[model samples]
Target: MSDAAIHPTAIVGQHARIGKGVKIGPYCIVGDKVILHDNVELVSHVVIDGNTEVGAGSRIFPFASVGLQPQDLKYHGENSRLVIGERCTIREGATLNPGTEGGGMLTKIGNDCLIMASAHVAHDAIIGNNVIMANYVGIAGHCQVGDNVIFGGNCVVHQFTRVGAHAFIGAHSMVDGDVIPYGMAVGNRAVLTGLNLVGLKRRKFDREEIHKLRAAYRMIFASEGTLRERVEDAAELFKGNALVQDVVAFIAAASDRPILLPRNGPTLD
Candidate 1:
């Protein structure tokens, strides 16, 4: 007998691969190509459609529409995929869509992510490990959210935007640009308000590192010749500080979207 404990009311397709100790709750629907890894729990009313593979120990709450078809009109039923990593908690009403062909045919989420209720991760969005998305957060297609980032409730990230590691997007913010590593962005049209000092401290960043990063942040966004020149100057000046280097390197890379800059002036802790 299979080790999986499947509720009688749940509908799991014959071709679906249910790993050991996987539990399918009442009214859950598993598609033909879905793969639930060991210790995965799908609460009642959860739907896993398309070619989706959820990693071990991930618990999904009720009413989540995971790995569904892409909402894009350009999606012509291609064999796209949605891959969720281990220990992810997908809360109620969250919607994660599969990728379109143009966006590499895979929407991937890394380990230990907390996707809160009603958050929507659109087609081909790549979310890194340890990310947190509060209720009603919306990530548009092709957005890249880096590791340990946090998005407050109701924030909407525009298509093709990139939010770097350790960044924070405040509630109700609309991000239409790239957010640099360790940047804290907040506004209707999100601007880099400051460094995520609280987050860095909570993550155990040393005092000196934070101080140096603060210095680098000030120089990078000061009213200078050009953003590119400021970035180069910060890179050279703070080359020894790893955290500052990360932001500098991120700015050096070419992006389809413009990066979010600090609003008004520098904000320091």
Candidate 2:
């Protein structure tokens, strides 16, 4: 409290834990149940309420509402939690909600995330580290967004969907299913277009690994066998390839939503 700087117009609850070097700018409101780690910054006109915790060094820009009650009709003041991770930047006008009882009572955003302006993270969404959500992206409730995922502007992900690690959701995509690891999804219905080869290359994945993944992808999506059969065959063929195995395991995982396939592939009912 001694080292923290709070503007005169800011209304921070007395019980709110303010760590050293924290900066609460003018017109900010922080509720009693909030816990701000060291060096956190609220850049004016921000409201953080509920049983929420913001990690160290995270900066929340103007008009961003965090740790608010969930929009779920079933949410009945259950003391659900919202946890934002370290060094993340939550841009202006973003809205983040806490979880409900039906969805583990926790909404968590991992470290180094860039939640762009006007993005919305609905209740119970578990977002992984280094993720990027472009402006106007909306993620519905209970969605699982894996590490290094990138959501382009105006993208909308349906509730309960799972987006795998390093996946890319193109602009204006309406994703309603499970997107596999390193996969690229685009368009209105959001079919799996291909691997996120550009991302892989930028991240320094070697040519041999990319080649193996491409081959496995082709085999798994071929119009020959059932999806389950194709996955099994790919698993056997790319047994030693870790990257391919990641895709295979993501597809094999139990999910309420269907695994997204290529536009030409057989659709899952």
Candidate 3:
């Protein structure tokens, strides 16, 4: 379009589809299979390649690399796609890789996500809306991250893990298991320390609901009983509370990795 602004230093491939009012700044390289939706802004030195589709009003900062080939050793140059939703902010040096042949050939990021600088979203990661990944966070391949999840700086999520909605992961945590909804996970191995009380309160969760969830957390992790025993007790005690029920269901549905157990004191290990 005539009103669309593209700097002379940028390289837009012949088959690339750039929408109305899109702005490409200096030294950006948009590949042939890429599609940039309306009002999207690409800052300097960004490279958007592969079969990537960027939605409207999104912004890519300097040195970000989106939609590259999957890093999986099993990837064999198969056709894949990376879909980024509207109004998303990808900060400088963020790298989002496409899916591998084994991972369904698609990686997705939902609307309004703030992916901070130097964050890495590996092959086939599916991130839901309103997610905030802080600086240098690393999400491994095929991880499913739910809506409104907040990952602190330098957090590392292992492959095939699921982070449920409204979960808050503290900085430098290494998450290897599924994170339950409304939970706060912290420490090196990412233990479910407690309910994300402050975050829930900020999100307008009622005080009564918070109390119920806190009670559920106490039964799940703080109590002296075994995990199976705790779940059985929680089923009887907190059946009326939907949030508590969700936590119980989460524990029941966990397959390989168990939820983190609470320690007696604040030990890093």
lDDT of 1 at 260: 89
- Candidate 2 lowest-lDDT run of ten: 260-269
Q: In terms of TM-score, how similar is model 1 to the real structure?
A: 0.98
Q: Highest TM-score, which number?
A: 1
Off by over 4 Å in 2: 265-269
TM-scores, each model vs. reference: 0.98, 0.97, 0.91
The lDDT-based order of candidates, best leading, equals: 2, 1, 3
Indicate whether candidate 1 or candidate 3 has the larger TM-score.
1
lDDT, candidate 2, 56-115, per-residue tens: 999999999999889999999998999999999999999999999999999999999999
* Candidate 3 residue pairs in backbone clash: none
How well is each residue in 73-165 modelled by candidate 3, as lDDT tens digits? 999999989999999999999999998878888899999999999999999999999999999999999998889999999999999898888
Cα deviation at 265, candidate 1, in Å, is 2.3
> Per-residue lDDT of 1-269 in model 1, one digit per residue for the tens?
19999999999999999999999999999999999999999989999988999999999999999998898999999999999999999999999999999999999999999999999999999999999999999999999989999999999999989999999999999999999999999998889899999999999999999999999898888886778898889889888999999998887875445998877877675
